[model samples]
Target: MKSLMQDVPLTLDVVLRRCLETGVGVEVVSATPAGTVRTTWGEIGRRATALTGVLDGLGVPAGGRVATFAWNTHRHVELFLGVPCAGRVVHGVNVRLTDDEILYQLRNAGDEVLFVDASLTDRLAELADRLPVRAVVVLDDGAPVNPVFADAPRYDALVEAVRETELVPRAKPDDAAWICYTSGTTGMPKGVVSSHLACVVHSLSSMTVDSHAVSREDVLLTVTPLFHVNAWGLAYTSALANAKLVLPGRDASGAHLAELIEAEHVTVGAAVPTVWVDLVGQPHRMDSMRRVLCGGAPATRSLLDAIARRGWAFHKGWGMTEMLPSGTMQVQPPDLDLDSPAGAITRVGKPSAGVRVRLVGPDGQVLPWDGRTTGELETSGPWVIRAYLDPDDDSNDTRFHDGWLRTGDLAVIHPDATVEIVDRVKDVIKSGGEWISSLALEQALAAHPGVAEVAVVAIPDDKWGERPAAAVVAADGLAPCAEELVKFLAERVPRWWLPERIVQVDALPLTTIGKPDKKALRARLSSPSRS
Candidate 1:
């Protein structure tokens, strides 16, 4: 069925190859606690091509999965381009996953070639028995390779052996480039395999839409892990665009990130809402940052306001693991009132340049776009995942209808096609036969100056099927009190819609992937009932 999409092979591999030849003068920066490392495009090309030789020497099959259990360093960044372009799958393993979970994924991915950063070698060595890895490569050269694994290799030595190589074999557009796993909150994590074509489009649209909207001269901060959607597709677009890409290593804490942003003169960046909370409110210098593309969860209205007050724009984003983890973005529409109330910035905004959206009811009927009728939001387009990769082998065909994929997210579409996500379809709070959105209440509480964190969830109520509860973090100069927050909410929502109870906590229980762990919160608050 080769529909003749493009015989020229419009893949990510091809893009990087062209960049080395045409954009060799571009700057690529990687920042670590050790210090900042700088490399030009030619070096990137040489390193990546040489790494291909290392993979070939290791007997890595063309379609074999090469796994990386490492931090966000330039060396890690090299593998981001090299493995896939070399006609192999790069599985950027989530280091945050539990030990048992990590073993489960390696087995599920059947990954044979392992790349371990020196920082992770001690921990990774312990799991060598559990993985089918034929070879283990370490990123840190000075550190002795943990002898727990017999086949482990050093990353730099492998590259040095192939430094004289000029070119690496390229992958076709449809060849699998990388593998990203989705949090299996209900069970085990499933793989989301992306092809070179889908990835190329994802990165191109991302750079055009956001990615610091970086120009040739801009420098970027990739505090977001390179393991996540190729660090939210920033490296892909930035290479060809001639921007300098900065990696903050794995230290994403406020102090470390603030230091890197200032020292590197980072002009653009992306991170979750919490990563910036401490940085934005800290007593450090951040004059170089121009904008932050935030995702993994909604950035509170107050957080956005605080960053805006500092003069750098805050761009909000919403996506799932399936959309190459990119779906919609908010960039302050041309007519949006800069002085508009906090309500304006919370919405998910418009479809990305390469995606489509539809609001559908339980019956699968597409609803009109008026911003009132809410329904399960479904989307399908280039770069959108057709179905998740299941180790147990579930039917992926069912995940797609016609050509569209059911995103399992709910939203209301405005006349302008901008979307306001209410909550996950399963997360809506049901009370007295009416459904209320948990997202709305959280956004309301977030607007209050004295609230630093908030999570809205359903709790059991005998009178009503389910009631809403709010867990909050007290702001500076404010005591942690539930009653006052309830009163604050009353002014925003109808009395019936207000959270029935409030609990104060220092922080919300964020998932390993950085999203709110609503399911875990609900279990913690209430016991399972047979009713």
Candidate 2:
């Protein structure tokens, strides 16, 4: 009988002292390159307590690892609340990877203190002498500094030389705050980490009114990429819902996020689905947004009917980066049919609360969520990732098993537990033995009105040992015709899932985070002159 309450500690300094006592005058803005700046949540909680006295005068220790590589500004939301409320850990990094994946994630997260982003100091001055980082700082954004970080040190003069030092929070809701990594698209990128009670319970389960409800009269924006996964956490649920955050630095174009969501009347934006297909083809006035969220991929029901013809409210989520980036969220189930193509509007819905989700099969059994039983989705609770920070790594024997988290997608689940993902156990395709689904043939050829972008991928078919090959990209003056997108996927999928080759291209080799690389389109459709 160990009852009597009061166990406190879920840290990030209690979401930075409740966003500095209730968002003291809200607004955080930042479109920098020496431009929009702004700042508030009580001056970013006194510049994140002067960035924890510039990470304790750059010594950084207590669980170390800082690293930022900037962009989603307001000084990367003050190193996402001064490096995990000064107990230290932050990590972010991604800045569109490769420079050998940013020196293999700064030597696999031994990070230390790198900050950066004066227009990314000549790509971090060629890995600032192979960074195991101890002090680089920068952040300036008016560009022009990289004389190999001309004697480094200048995140606003080291937070104005520790702006009257006070630095309190020493963290500990199971410490190690945020590390992120995995866009290695099925390979190298690993490191997950999280905790500070799993980022304050995934920012109070993303302000739950069915997740991503995010409040304080919402105004968010984060075109996802505060070095990736955490941006998907919507910058800590817009600083624990004291909302109004914005930051579009490094122009996430589509007419600069439709003029920064119509000059910041931005009521909740989040990104991906290729930045909402370049903000549904630019040209402005965002009518104060009102819900967009989307996640790394799968949105195309003609980009959710071109973001429901701009009345916004898209919401397709489903996560990873080991699930600290969210687990599932599509919430629009009122007897479903948001223009049905087998509705549940691109289902990624159920399982956000403490996240459980199952569906195993291919013999390990545990399937039946019934909605036509496809399998391989597994997941598990309180902000997921129970492994992968290399403990004798072997990708923990194929991405963990007994404690769930295999999530190589390939979903379905439905009998009210919603889900529906449909492929990526290395992008599924089997063919003559019948499996198919390269994301349900790239969502039925992205609902073909002359397909703007698609992907599919699974080639090698001398007797159906594996068929399904697409690639597309048209829409804009339409030329569509690979037998009219296989007769528009022969009335939607399963004529042995169509496409034995479609091609078209003009762009669709993405993944530096904008996904759709399909392993570089199955090595450019298995070569020999694009097969």
Candidate 3:
């Protein structure tokens, strides 16, 4: 029988209240256009109270959704703490998404209120009637001004008179605290439903020195966009953990990101490998960043080695939106076969502290930990979401077996429990009955001196069902032919593993979340481009 004590208060507001008592007056620094700004947890708590009052004024109920289509800023961070803490769900929508897709998700999620940046007031206007928003609040650092809202209430004035209303949000541990939507390019982005218990459980599991390694003394710099899994779960963890948070404030460019890292003495930072790579490409070390958490795509060995040389530990963070994106951490293993060219650097260290990871074949057979056995990664833990908003879809039906969420990621688990992903399950190429690793190909090609960026996709081949083709960006003054690049990789990969064709370009298209747009690359192969 389950213990009654197990039903104890596990809601997010519980953590917020605890932090207010314990971590009050802790600095929350955010780099903004008006120079760096600083505030404390108490002020944030008060602001959250104000926000909750405003939410109430705007007709947001306990379960109603208050959407945020803004970048990472102090105001955005406030929503992270206050909205959910005040007992309302904040649907952090990805701003980079198309107008249509964004509106589709906004409607699908049935957002009742919106908190958007003044810059994106136009985005909200386009979806106004289509979306179910009852009010629209435009947030800014200065005196508030009304934006052109056709019907929704202007937010600045809504919360203007609010004096810290003690809005202690009510939420059961199992009640949904937040919701996140996937990039619907493949299909309509599935909204991931997570509970307060789930988010808190995942945070405890991820808080260890081995995982995200967050500490009160440390500062975290990120511009990964708050719309993505509550900024990949960093927003919630930082506030509840009392970690110094440095938001990149709308400018996630390489120069701006480097500046924040140096100015704030950012000890811990995270972004896609593309952003980090851009930082490394800069002439000098901006500041000594000790730890970097990278995901949104696999971190190639080449990129990892570059960070290592500069005394930075780039841990591979692998997770989907469903798990609150907290599943695996590839820290350097003790038995890392340093002799093996790949093990000299780190691996996704191990399944996050409390996460149980399993690789299984068809028919539900668990695979071995030999690292040679590759299978679909299935996981179930305190944080893993059980179902989607519309759980009837058959596409997502096969995503879970029993209670474990089939990650759709092809991975190998070493004896040490370190998870290394080779490629996405759907993207793995089969050519004439032979499996080709697109990840391995991309990693090898990224090592070449002249190659600035690369994306490999399987192209239709009549002889072989599909063959590998690469879309590559070359270094300045270097015009390497597809044949020449192929020869370069030939020396590294198996003859059959080499890409049959290559498309030279200046840049690779990327998903809104900063992943190399393999979907776009696959589109190009439909009509191969020539330099």
What's the lDDT for all of these models? 0.78, 0.80, 0.76
Writing each residue's lDDT as its tens digit, candidate 3 over 312-403 gives 76667888898888787766433334347346332455788677889898678999988788888899888886778876767557778888
Query: lDDT, candidate 3, residue 254?
Result: 79
After best superposition, candidate 3 residue 403: deviation in angstroms? 1.0
Q: How do the residues 381-488 of candidate 1 rate in per-residue lDDT, one tens digit apiece?
A: 888877777734563764566678777678888998888887877778989999898888888888887888888889999999899987787777776477777788
Clashing pairs in 2: 424-427
Better model by TM-score, 2 or 3?
3
TM-score of each: 0.93, 0.34, 0.92
Clash count for each candidate, listed in order shown: 0, 1, 8
Residue-wise lDDT of candidate 2 within 25-130, one digit each (tens)? 8888988888887877767777777777778778887888888888888878778777788778888887777788887888788887788888888876876777
Candidate 1 off by > 4 Å: 1-7, 141-151, 209-212, 333-343, 391-398, 527-531
Over all chains combined, what TM-score does candidate 2 have? 0.34
Model 1 is weakest, by summed lDDT over 10 consecutive residues, at 333-342
Which residue window of length 10 is worst by lDDT in model 2? 333-342
RMSD of each: 3.1, 21.2, 2.8
Candidate 3: what lDDT? 0.76
lDDT of 2 at 74: 80
